[model samples]
Target: MLPTTRGDFWAEITQIGMDRLWMQRFHVSLPQVSTVASRPGRRSIGFLTECNSSPLQHCGLNVLSGDIIVNKFDLAHHRSGADYHLGTMSLPTDELDTAVEVIIGRELLKSPDQRIVHPHPALMSRLLKLHKAVGQLARDTPDILERPEVARALENELVHVMVRCLAEGASADTTTGVRRHDAIMARFEEFLEANPDRPLYLTEICAAIGAAERTLRASCEEHLGMGPIRYLTLRRMHLVRRTLLHSDPSKVTVTQVVTDHGFWELGRFSVAYRMLFGESPSCTLRRPAEQPNIHLSRPSSLTTAEPRAT
Candidate 1:
């Protein structure tokens, strides 16, 4: 677990298959944090199961019904809510293909396409059970996990189960729907990331992404549990906090950094930032390079900053 002042960001991994299969459980309580994860060394498949309501509170891109399986080819950014939680089991290039051939009788190993598959009901149930077991094993049985035979057994079981789950979930409609939602959000996120420091209105973003205003708003609300405006603002807030954490107080001012990120309403921004991150912006800016201590709970009475005349 990686500890920060706000809370602990922890991940437990069980390695197997010559460092190919990595069964992992991740959790954090940092508000408005983004995690960029990539495959280790080679291309791999990621079998992910959602853990409670932890990851959803934020506008995470991978939010889907049932267990999800994704092919990781490059770095992917995931946004987290105040309380982030998820579980993952990894499969290497060769192993994933071999498992797919053996279980589902199809070729998938060398496929570079990014795919997100949601397992059907029975398979989702099993996947959830496996997620629980992995968490329990990580917490309770470190000694057993150290045994070579036990680790191999666990890896084999995970690969087989995942293949079965994926095969069962191969419905055209479900796959198309999930892929469409993911594709639309990816476009929106890309646009926002590329224009981070600009104060472009949401309508402009919607136009750039080639979607009607209402359509984009509805898509974001359904997939991300938040509307476009709020998500963009939260993302900008996160960007400002990141800059503050990494910037030298001697070199930069909080107002300068925040304004550059398009946060025009200084008072409301401070109140929202404090509510989300549990500290004032100036505190973060003045600190030596360190992770912000985050708290999941918000202050009951948040005092807004008084707007200064330009």
Candidate 2:
């Protein structure tokens, strides 16, 4: 994922796995945005647990604090505001489908699109507390999951609550305008992927992507929280930083790397780089290679239970 704003980036992620269920709680140290979807064979739910003035944009809609988002196995774009903490869970789609059939007797959702779910405040509170308790187990006492009965009990309860939220919650509808913007963003990303080595001006970007400038501007603003020009430059800046951090300073010069990423003005590039990254390009290149800052818990599974305590 590309960091939208600049700083030393680090993330703390705690993950837990049950027999057929998976869960994650993560926090990033930077203001950033990324798209997340269901894993290849799973259905996922993401909740923005904390926020203040700025609400998160989920699949092109504003998700206020305490709101949960359900991914219909579709690409869901989320932009987090500062002090963001997100919790997510996923299980096999078939498992969810069966549960909906059995419990709710009708499919909670039939559309394959990201939708927001607003549950009662008390119910939402209980879900958050339970999620937080489980995450704590993953971080501080993962061996607790080594107990078969305990793990099974927690997993079942979590699933029950999840189904209840889906069945009883008020699901928000995505506007036609939001869908149009989502399509535009898809094409825009395709263009970026197809031409990764160079920078294009706003006019050329719109022309190549087959989107009008006004429409593209609104799409970017709503989904990306920034103008097209700023988003493009910021993404490229992150790319340059990542390369510089990993490249061998002995063989490559900062000038070569910067120009390769499509920055033509060396002097102005250096200024902008320093302003965003808090360091000069050469300084970043010279630093020794360090381990990635992401902290991920080794996930636990219920199948491997330890011997019962005496």
Candidate 3:
């Protein structure tokens, strides 16, 4: 059970004998004046939007202020105002949301792990427009919670519409070969997992994946919500934190562990590690032994400059 500032929201663990999947729900209530903080995670099919008519900050990297709704395929980091609810279908990592109703609505009628790679600008525009429309409908539809069936129907309809829009406008990018995008991502993931303790350069990852730097970067941006190096660095940090808490500190020096995970620059690694985990690597090592668990804290506000909304 992680203790979020809002309260103690228990992380749920669903275990089928030995197989297990962890999930959690977070409901944050902030004073109207406070700025929402940015959080990170893996790509998920989930819904996150303002409730009770609040402005959305940093929508799509363009700071859009309005009641904006988002059904994101890739990972996102943002702040929000007003009370928000989240649900997770699988893991309860900081990267997952607890808005299961919204995720199921979108993913039920679509392919598994639906991802957009090399999305055409036209298609991206239409999808955003559809999202806006659905969000409006949701806001206007009153007493949705009063009738569960009606609420479910409406959510399902919105998902269907969004999926149709994506299918209609999506086109293959001839330059990158859209079909091979997933393969590249798989290779990248494998590489990251195998070398989680080593510092990795974007060029090195591109070489390992056998793709040009531009191509690799484009796909990473489209599918992972960040460039390859950023994603890998975060992943490495996550692993290192986990190891520090669960393994014997005497066996692994902090420098060796972090550098082995592909983080060559000591200063940068220390700063990022401290920023993400909410403590220095040395501090984590000195703490008394505890259960194996890791929670990557949201970065400080200064590191995230608000993007201009398009």
The C-alpha TM-scores of every prediction are 0.65, 0.88, 0.44
Worst 10 residues of 1 by lDDT: 301-310
Each candidate's lDDT (Cα)?
0.60, 0.76, 0.43
Off by over 4 Å in 3: 1-180, 289-310
Residue-wise lDDT of candidate 2 within 177-281, one digit each (tens)?
A: 888888888788778767767768899989988889999999999988888888788778878887887899999999889888888898999999888878899
| Model 3 C-alpha RMSD to native | 12.7
Candidate with the greatest TM-score versus the true structure: 2
Question: Candidate 3: worst 10 consecutive residues by lDDT?
Answer: 301-310
- What is residue 65's positional error in candidate 1, in angstroms? 8.8
- Please tell me which predicted candidate would have the highest lDDT against the true structure: 2
Please give the lDDT score for candidate 3.
0.43
Rank candidates by lDDT, best first: 2, 1, 3
